[model samples]
Target chain A: MQTSTHANPRALRDIEMALERTKAEIPVLTPMVTAFGPLLAERFRLREAASGWVGPLPVVDAERFSQGVFVLADSGFQDMSAHLSEAAHGLLPIMANSFPAMAQELNTLIAAMDNGALTMDALAAAGFGEAFTVPGVNAETMDFAVAELVRPFVERQAQDLAKLVRDLPWRQTICPICGGTPNMSVLRRIRNDSEFIQAHGGRRFLRCSCCATEWTHKRISCPSCGCEEPDELVVLSDPSRPFERADACHRCKTFLLCLDTGELADIPDPDVAALTMLPLAHQARRQGFVPLAEHPWGGL
Target chain B: MPKAIFIDTTRCTACRGCQVACKEWKNFPAVPTKQRGTHQNPPDLTHYNFKLVRFSEHLEGDVVQWYFFPDQCRHCLEPPCKEASTVDGAIIRDDATGAVIYTEKSSKEDLETVRSACPYNIPRQDPVTKRLVKCDMCIDRVRANLLPMCVKSCAMGAMNFGNREDMLKLAGERLEAVKKEFPKASLLNQDDVSVIYLVADLPAKYHEFAVAGVSGSMTRKQMLARIFAPVRKIGQQVRG
Candidate 1:
């Protein structure tokens, strides 16, 4: 059995600490924290393991590139599917023992995904269409849960493709590996040899919500509409909290939440930071603007 | 990055979408109004309306050209109101977004002093709440990854927002394009305020305070006060 070490142990610890802090700060989120926290930690472990299994992926043609262009073309998909199925099986207790055959179904889904046979239409045809539906849960909520469960396996394939085409000239707003809209934007400070200290300058990276692929994008443009007109974009930030802000575009009526990691004492998991900004999401919705991607926390 | 909004006055159709959207988003109660002989209803920015689309008319050769100016707080880079306010938290500038915010504590401050300090005559006081109010740049929405309601509701592409550098660049580009047709096209107070207005005509053809330097003459004492305001606040903090 290959031991899973997808995320670095220290990073995993940090994520746990962030979850704990988030739980402490928002008591209402305790139930959710208790439910998904362990799963996320496990996912991190899977991601760490996946990081080590990097292999050559087929080059994506720049001309006809789309987010779904890269499909799993290696035998590693089998190992990834097996590992993820085991992970999904571990969740049976928390899932109230529902979806008893989830592991077998997940394996089937993984194989189908690897072979480009796992589209929504295909899933519907295979009678797994309602697999995500739970009695009281909204479709979006259920979809989020399902995505979380399968993310580790999907991330493995995405990581390999991301590495293979890291230097490709990808200009699309969607992720080159998964074709998914970015869930979070992170700003990291740039350090040069002349400046021993970190410079105020930074680059913006868009992280895919589905497969965890990250790509660099223009700092001032809207990721949704590709609005390079600076006049059509706005940065909204809470006066009380200066570290996080929403980059909203007037043209597309879309916004993307961004976190400045350089301002923090310790780097936080982008996912955790995004979750904590649920109040901001509410504020955005009230103003009639939507996010670039349909985020799990967006329903809140 | 510090953020800004660019208003292209040439594109404003005076639909009042921005004005209505600002009120709707802020949830400010409507103030009674009568038609003021022109399409510019309510006439001026009131306590209920943080944003007002001002209308003015001028004769260009033979045709009567109507100008629309959506008036709101400029959210000055170095806000004079912030400098003039003695009350703690009465006025604050968000370092992250460059939004000049008037807090609830502003109710306790001398409203006239804060009002007089503005170069653009933007601030208004709510008679009931006593809180000084202005366009907050929709800081709440902006922080939440949403465009300001005014910007969102504007279908004409007149109002826009983004980082200060990008907005400035856009203003320059738009000004160049607009000047090709309207020789007098210019950007209003681009260097000193978060809201940059790209007007297609002379500044006077718009509202009186459409450009800075048209209002609120600064005394030497006020200038000194503006310069030393930060030091004085810090000194007060130390003393306290």
Candidate 2:
């Protein structure tokens, strides 16, 4: 095992404290569990696009790079090809934007990979890349690229929040710390576990980047146009997950994806977790709705 | 009306959302790249990657300064690339978005000359097509009343686009606020280019050539040609 050579005294102290915390919390964060266990049992479902669909999700044809999923593993042109899948890649990119720093990291990783500067192993080790257990090269490639682009953006965004916010502001969508846009207009990622809540978890939401400030955008309020009009705000859902829906603001012709995690046993990765709702955005876009926020990994 | 992009480095988190979004929106295919140790992927601007978030980190005293420069074409007010390339319609200024567009006609000109003329060192040529390319400020999206994909996908408020007057106003307000925190904050090429950069530190700290340079004088013959070419062309037409 290699040790980090952080020479800066303050940074080293911070790292030591963080390591202690991680060691103490390991039992909670890494509870022994089988892959695809009780965590996914509550709402593990898949929804496919309908015939003749003309929405945000692309129709399957020569461009159906993967079966119901867009992969960019060996894609010569990863960005251009990744969005072919309506349900998978379509939603991932928008959700990835929820963390701008991660999005940037992912973009760099992708560029590095294309330039042969990054390898699959290096990416996974640094937590900037992932390999899907999917069958074909296309599926794996797409998943790798998506993960590569998203992870760094997420970590860096969180890091910036910790360092930048001296006194967290009240009402705004942009991240005051870094004037970056957030893809998801989070109402709140409420922790159902009382133990976690006691660990300083509170109701904090994400913001869009155009103006840098994070406000309490209401859970039900349309993220686009700040429209609270019930009639103008349309929620689209499928049977796969009733809790998550695409909230489209008719007034602004923009849409936001929202997840109600109050019902989950665990916190979800908003980027990949939002994949189940891809059909809704596809349906909405076909109806002439533009996405107020887009995903970095998933697009079509 | 030529289009432009105003980048405020203070707002950038080195997120490459604009880069990916630009590729996605433009339907440009991804080029194969390898990790070169830096976060900057693909190394340099190519035919595919138009907008790149450049990263540079330095230590100034106790503060470890890490700078993010989202680099692209400056689209100079009076473009030197256009002046260097005499091929008709090679590079044009779009009336709608004020975008400097490089058409197929650019293939007729010498790529080296056009590339050298750019003060910002923008304009990459496709080896196969022999045409120059750079940021077009998402002109198609502008025409449709949609913000450029890069601007829209920017989760960081680093990239801003709008009417020149409005962007300038916003830039001014931001500059004032940034100055309170960074006394050295200043706008780059505010008057000479469409793409204005509001840098929080010395521009060089952000990226090499983050601002236009007057580092060297042109050679006597080259300088004379540039200075007298316009007058001579006009005189020849008048005499003819």
Candidate 3:
């Protein structure tokens, strides 16, 4: 569940591997998971390729970064055509499988991008957070799909520059790389230098909602409002599945679903891991705790 | 502080849910049994049954008073069984939770000596592996921030698990309330053991091994200290 922000080609394999493992581990999710497998694998392929080719994004300003400013929040990933075209090509067919009713609309969107009549940057400016002229696609689905498409470029930039700001404690609830809020929290296993285990992991790392960047966060603090009271933070989990959990903050009435990678047999890709905790997310919402951010498969 | 369990016997309905839950948690198979003409099944702790609810009946004038005691490892504050272990890592006391855990290496130790050292007579050795097996306070569940199986399964609110401080505070609050009805009510050896039981009546009325035996009135730590004094002195002298 602790998918590091390394956009190496192995991720292409890991995403599919995680999907297969998830199918084997929780057969109940196989049908829903099988449908999205190609889309996710293709996304990871773009991300790996972007890691090698896509670059020259703005470098982080250390002064602004220390003051809780995000690297690419203001100056967004420019000239989105290079990254967006291939992402759309790989995604449209897979999108067809999931959205058969919207096949006509999907084709329209596909043609617009292919012929350069419609650009992703133009779509971001005009359509995002507002009603889209592109017919038939729901706002939430559009947002989710756009986020998925743009993720590879953002992630590659974050991966390339992670070492520069690794040690500097931001203490902010959002991702330093893309100024994105966390979709989920992960308790990463901390390995010691020697043979003997110095400590067992409780280290909390928040995985970005947009770019897949992981940043250290206060374990007791609420991601929504930054409440630090231990009493306010309530842990909800199924005893049978100790790996999955939701940390509910009573103060803000918000919860973030979490995966303890230490308990899992394999380190699942972040997107795949969040899908596995669909039940926990439902449980959290049922308890009247709002999720900080939804995964790309928001409606599902 | 280490973890602790507070058992309020006053609230226990003798449902034996805890007993069944312990067996389920350990994944221990059922043993052959015949009706012994009592509600309590598997009457005592065995290799399979680490927890057993004892049903004791007493006649007070014309009234028949029944007391149910859920017996398991006390996980003593300073476990003498740990000192009695001859093999290293056999009887490990987890520093984090103070859980008296018997590992696979426990097979190397003399079962008699280690078992005898425990005031509660809780340790039961496996015939095949020879390792002492008992309630580990479900350390696996505790570490995962889940309630122990016995505590989780209890519907009567008789069992409570938490930090040692919290459990002690709860035991005191429960003891005060129970004392209003049953005057002889007390939290038994709360300081000496992590598993604090609030009994409604005299400790012996519940079980003989309730608060350690009458002959062995001293706490297990004190007894171990007395027995191992000579060995400690010799070791100190040898070091010097």
Candidate 4:
């Protein structure tokens, strides 16, 4: 069933308000996306595919085919709020229940923002991700950009992503619903607001693009070829986002980005947090392996 | 089991998630595009873009209805494009995924014949490689046990993929559900291809050749050649 709960007028209003706020926040977050350009570039393959967009590039013999796919994946949009909301929903209620006063305080902060006292900058200062600042971006854009940015990073976290993919529970020929691929491979680890035990809390597994099903993909396997050769497959990482890496298999010659939340102090929006690793993607592409997709914020 | 993708136009929000996902999964590139007074970016499919969501608006009674057809090579059971190719591995259907794959061999094939033989006007020639290209249904990914990229990326659930039996079932269910709302709703070319469409109106109302017959049949010689074409391949191999 289509989830009408979020499509109703009130929800639409909330989403619209959220989008407008998110767009406004773009000017503010531009600095962050710009700051981590190399990591993002490396992971996302930020380069021109062709002189023209609609037609073939000057290169031939399917070489451009690889580059083209790389470019699209890099720039693909991801729905940010949905995942953020999903993550936040789990974390929020606990705060509301355990520390009712802090929860009340958080509500007041949001209320102040609703009343225009808390600027997007202020929200960022308070550790809220940029997604809460913008408005108008539907779930699709967030989903695309987020997936584009994070998928490779997540894939890279596991040594042999292909093997990891082979073990995933939702491993099917097509997505159960939309027939898309795995956007973010998650390990079902949920963290409550209490101690904020940043690591090893949320679900653990790979997330599918079609149905967003998060299933267990082994930690050290190629997500594409399922090849078990660690020597044939290598993992590349960025110093900035030490938790993330680009896993490339020499055997299949395909690469997936990976993020190790076990290393982060906060729940990284696989999409937004991945901006720190784009340049690594570019470096990987220069080495000849193609990323699954382009990171969405590459050009922006 | 052979897999198929069921596209329900009625459910499409024209978000182009499938379009982007198809490119992403296939590892195809971004086609440079402009605002052509329509959201249909990059206009039509090309060598790099295997799947394209075509949008057309028409007046139905007093309402202006916008129709979207996420277009791609149909991967016909007997793909005319495959029959048109004289080169080996140029356009071979993977028996596993039933995916009509256009390999590098296409660069050597007679491009005009292959392009013209396509009933859906699909297939574009790459200027540089001189190879023909279209959707391969992400066979590599399918082989890796994942959904087709386009199917995976669709956010609106307009696109679906599964075994032929399941896709047909879903297509039938969608058709029946859609028919109650739109009496003319039906599935297009469900029998001949892996990509089946659940359209909410007369197929033609969506596109001139939205229906299977619109592309017309293969020429008499092409038809005959297609039948004998397989034998020709074996003969050439045996002779060599």
Candidate 2 residue lDDT tens string, A1-300: 000111222333333333333234333422211111221221111111212112233222322321222111222111212222222233334433433434554444445555656444444433333343322224434454444333333333333333223233333343333334456543343222121112112343554332122445445566446678789988877654554677788898877666554323223344333433456667878888877656543364
Task: Show model 1 residue runs off by greater than 4 Å.
Answer: A1-300, B214-240
Error of 1 at B40 (Å): 0.8
lDDT digits (tens) for residues B1-240 of candidate 1: 588999988778898999998999888888899977898888889999999999988887999989999999999988888988777888999997899999998887667767777778888998989999999999987765456778767666777776688789888988998898999888987888899999888898788878767334554434755776677566656765
From the highest TM-score down, the ranking of the candidates is: 3, 1, 2, 4
lDDT per residue as tens, model 3, B1-240: 488989989878888989999999899999888799887788778889989999889999999999999999999877878876666677888887878899998876666777777788888989998878999989887664556888866666687777788789888988887789899998878888889999999998999889865332555644774497457546644664
Candidate 2: Cα lDDT at B140: 63
In the order shown, the candidates' DockQ scores are 0.01, 0.01, 0.02, 0.01
Per-residue lDDT for B118 in model 1?
A: 79
TM-score, per-candidate, Cα-based? 0.49, 0.45, 0.54, 0.44
Give fnat of each prediction, in order. 0.00, 0.00, 0.00, 0.00
CA-based DockQ, model 1: 0.01
Cα shift from native, residue B229, model 1 (Å)? 8.3
> Which ten contiguous residues of candidate 1 chain B have the minimum total lDDT?
B213-222
Lowest-lDDT window of 10 residues in candidate 4 chain B? Answer: B213-222
C-alpha root-mean-square deviation, each candidate? 15.4, 25.9, 17.6, 24.0
lDDT tens per residue, model 4, A1-300: 010001122323333332333234344544444433323333322111111122232222234322222112233222222222232333333333443434554444434545666453433322312444324333333333333333332323221222223322343322222234554443333322232212333334554442233445566677777887869989787564455677888988877666665422223344543444556666777898875544444333
